[model samples]
Target chain A: MGHLILRVTIKILFAPIILFAFYVQFHGDYGPGGGFQAGVILASAFILHALGFGLATCQKVIPPNWLPAGMALGVLIYAGTGIYTMLFGDNFLDYDVIQPDSHHHAGQHIGIIAVEIGVGLAVACTMLQIFYAFAGREPEPMDDAW
Target chain B: MMLAAAASAEVGSEVTPSTPEVVGFTGAFAVELCLLALLAATAVAMIRMRRLFGVAMLSGIYSLLSAAFFVALDAVDVAFTEAAVGAGMSTVLLLSGIALTAKVEMPVSRTRTIAPLIIVGVTAAALVYATIDMPGFGDANAPANAYVGRAYIEQTPSDIEVPNVVTAVLASYRGFDTFGETVVVFTAGLACLLLLGAGAIRGGGRNDDGEH
Candidate 1:
């Protein structure tokens, strides 16, 4: 964490990792990535930052207090999308009713993107929250000879 | 399902292999074989190593090797998940676990290993026997290939208008399952918070109890 090169490199990589996560998040409709992958990628950026700068600084950037709420909020968004569709008189998660004035294609696209973002948010927050729990436990300093 | 699709696609491409195609397939298979071998080696090393750090490193290597295998199978999405989750995130978690616990595994008694060995051996045998009943790798006439698989492939463009069928199926057709998965992840995060994370906030972040 005190190493200057590692800290500087992590600083450089942080933006790109989050950018890539977003790319994968939105590009799922066309490519081989989706919410889960994007979420993990996003979490990895924070984890890398934590490893380089220590947990306190990482938590300063993404406070632990918000993680649990964020996790729940993601699932709420997903379930809310389903509920919204159901309110339109369709079956649970049926996208055809999402945009009553438009064709099924547009509705499906919109619904899928919304749910994907929900998934990404939930997964990202959950991963970070779990990491915080693990990293928070203090360890006895070990000999570095190994 | 993704693995099945990839295997079938690979088989379909292999059917018309010119010299170049054959060479390419052969080279790919060779790479897969090497990766699998390395994966096995890493697993063995993990088991033999008493040092938790070495075991952690070996397990990360194992995950990376499996990620490579997933790529060889043309399951790029799965490979991405395995690389990120298995190799990347899990490694960090395991290292954190070691920081909380012992750096070396305690030596086990010979008698203590017998039951676990039998259980593992039986499970392995059962899995192998189950595979014997499965359709051959990439068989076009397999039940999955004959039914919903074909439907998804054929109807995705028309029905969902999504270029990625996996996304369409995950987010739309099987939306409930994904919702459940999200909830499960949320629950796990919450559980971790309640178990270990809550203490720090309650204790004003000092951890003065001297317990990990």
Candidate 2:
């Protein structure tokens, strides 16, 4: 069937992109890869899936109502890290001061990863949501003046 | 502080520095130049094309080529955003708009062609002139790296504790800019929602019957 072939092709194309995204996120310290690039790559993979499959299928995967919540959650996670630092008797986003007794270096790395994950989540979800919104809807008519 | 530590380590390294193999730089340069030429050619083609859909697709290619240029410059974040927004989102929106209006592009007139050509020529000349006195590409010790970037590398870790300098700069030192960017994203979402909501309502009213 047409749907089966499409699904197989989609999986083939998407698997590598997802793997590469994880590589970019983790290997950013060594080279030119980072959270943003990883996020976009992941988002593009999903957008491609949405394009190939029907918009209804895409909606089932990422419902419109869930998208706003995801975006807010991502922003909150990022802001929450800063708030944690602030509450621990330091300036906002001062990860070194997170835990005075523990090794500060470990804490800093944890904090950076947390924030990067938040950014990645926000960007990926927002991009997919935008594509869904645009592609799922039909167009309006032109003005009657003509 | 990390950069300084790295720099100090570099000073005492026993290994001799050598250019890492980056494929064929000449071939890469030739390909990049060809892409740039293709971008320009496509822009002209888009203008001359009689079909609006073709123009939109050509413009999308132009955006993608610019994104490739950004990647070649090692600006991955910018390239990501451009590929998503400019190439992906804008093209979709433009096509949707065209679907709502006329499907064909308006015929080009001599008056329109002359103005755009002159504008493009003047802009290109200015850019060429500006690049003449610029430092060579990828110069590590260029003014950009020496001054503006140096401060962030030196001070941010001690203060913000983020190993990634770009993240530290965007989220902490330049937090206001990030805030502004968030607002821009929110505003765009709001505008799209409003516009799309109106369209949906009108579409529904027109199609009260279940039949297409």
Candidate 3:
């Protein structure tokens, strides 16, 4: 029951944070928010969860073993966008060249969004992984337990 | 020819704001000052704290306030990066390091601290003197604004089609720097993994039954 209450409280806190992260990601073009802010905000939610629920439960949700893979995948996703642009016959990171149609503006938007998502994923995962690496050490069992 | 073209480009563009813009500018300036004060307080706290956790938390606050200052300065991308790398990732890593070592930082000795104090004093004085000759905050016609920024703003849209100036500067004009930063992050991760060991065994040991 205590765990259930904690889960509900976390859910309530998490919903707004996720909303803010998305806002930072998309609204960055107009204001002082962007991929980095979104990534940190998203990572903070997980960090808070880990702090409250113990590292073990947090690991169940985001296993430490998969963190490096997630980080690498995020970087690959970001770089892949530039690679895609190059493959499409433009210079690296040339968004317009990726699609090269009348709706080139749309292409730019899509490319930017894709790259931001990649950044957010990489940052969030790396942060959580770091926390796991540091706080994950188990306490030695007491001999008296036997 | 290239020099003439560059000179012409410099003269053609400048960020001249109107009356309402001035009001907005003043508002931003006030916000920037408040954030700077907050950052200073955090730095002071970090320096004064003997507990490692307190110092780590203060450093995170410093990062967050610096991010706010960056936003006020219209460097959104930098603000974002600082908030993530500094406040989010670095704090976590520091705390992790603390977990491996002592929670409380050793108190500074009166005997050993004099050298550091003198060094800090000298550095601060030098920085203050350097700032005196700097162009006034947000001077659109300053050399930094006139040369590199103007060139990028005018030229990058035609080339890259991205509207965000920070994005253009980071991913296009100074792309190599961004790549280097990414490499640094990758290296930090590698170092943590190597020094700390595998992620699974970090927080605690698993039993023979495989329970964490």
Candidate 4:
């Protein structure tokens, strides 16, 4: 009964929080935020969910198996972009040549976005993975104690 | 200082108001000082608090204050990261830790506390002394602003086409460093997973150290 309000509030908030994370993620090239901040923002949303809904419930939604795998996948995406640039006979991570005939760093735009997304995924999942390791080991504490 | 920022922003709206005014530090140094004072007070309170839970909360407040301080210095990106990671995520993580452990910190002996306090005081005094010689905020003639930092600010648009120079530098100019940092973060997470085992992966649930 005590959790009814928290559950409702989080339910209301969950979507917007995720949306804002992506906003921060993509908006970095133009604004004051980027992947690290956005990733933490995204992870906090889930962490908040885990707080309200209980670890087991949250784990069921996200699945613990995806955490470590997702972490490595993000790193791969980031490094893969770098490696892809290298394959094109360009210096590593030199975005200018990634798209041969593009005008004025169009390739750079593509590269930064891809790399940022990779960073976002890696950071978000790593944070969640760490949270699961910490929060998963124990049952929910007594509601009043919190 | 915040009051002045708000007032000036209002005045700015009255003029060429197409764009909102940047939160400038031109006349807001006092606000930064006040924020730093609040941060110091919060840190002191955190130390004095016996309950680990209370300390965690105070530390979160300290993070928030410092985030505001960062904003006053025109480091919006840093402030954003600090607010999210320091104030938001770390606070929640600390609480999760407290839930797993004891809420109250163990009381230390009076005599034992004195030695650490003296060490902390001396270190802080030294840091303060060092700060006295450091360049003032936004000092263009300072080494950073005068040299490579200025070059980055000048070259970013031409080199990367990113409006946010920090992002341009981080993802492009400093691409190798950012890649290394990502790898480092990935490695640390892997190490943690190896040691602790992701909750469900190890034991089924609570008290699931497996051997038990």
Best model number under lDDT: 1
Q: Give TM-scores for every candidate, taking all chains together and pairing residue i with residue i.
A: 0.87, 0.72, 0.76, 0.87
Q: Please give the ranking of all candidate structures by DockQ, highest first, separated by commas.
A: 1, 4, 3, 2
Q: Write the per-residue lDDT of candidate 1 for residues A20-71, one digit (tens) a residue.
A: 9999999999998999999999999999999999988888878887887899
- Interface RMSD, per-candidate values to 1 decimal: 2.3, 4.6, 3.9, 2.7
Per-residue CA lDDT of model 4 for B1-212, tens digit only, reads 12222322232222222112335554564565576567656765776788888888877887787788767667899999989988998898888778777777777778886766666556555555665566655567889789889999999888788899999989998888998988888887788677665454553366445675
lDDT of each: 0.80, 0.62, 0.66, 0.78
lDDT of 3 by residue, B165-198 (tens): 7766665566546545555665666566666557
**Residue B36 lDDT (model 1):** 59
Span of ten consecutive residues with least summed lDDT in model 1 chain B: B12-21
> How well does model 2 score by local distance difference test?
0.62
Question: Could you give candidate 2's per-residue lDDT for residues B1-212 as a string of tens digits?
Answer: 12222322232121112112334667666665675666656666765677888878876887787788667656776776677667876786677567557777556667766765665556555555655556555666869878878898898667656566776676556654654454455445545545555322222222223445
Instruction: Say what the interface RMSD of candidate 4 is.
Output: 2.7
Evaluated on CA atoms against the true complex, candidate 3 attains a DockQ of 0.34
Q: Is the docking of candidate 1 incorrect, acceptable, medium or high quality?
A: medium
Candidate 3 structure quality by residue, lDDT tens digits, A39-74: 778877877677667777877877777788877887
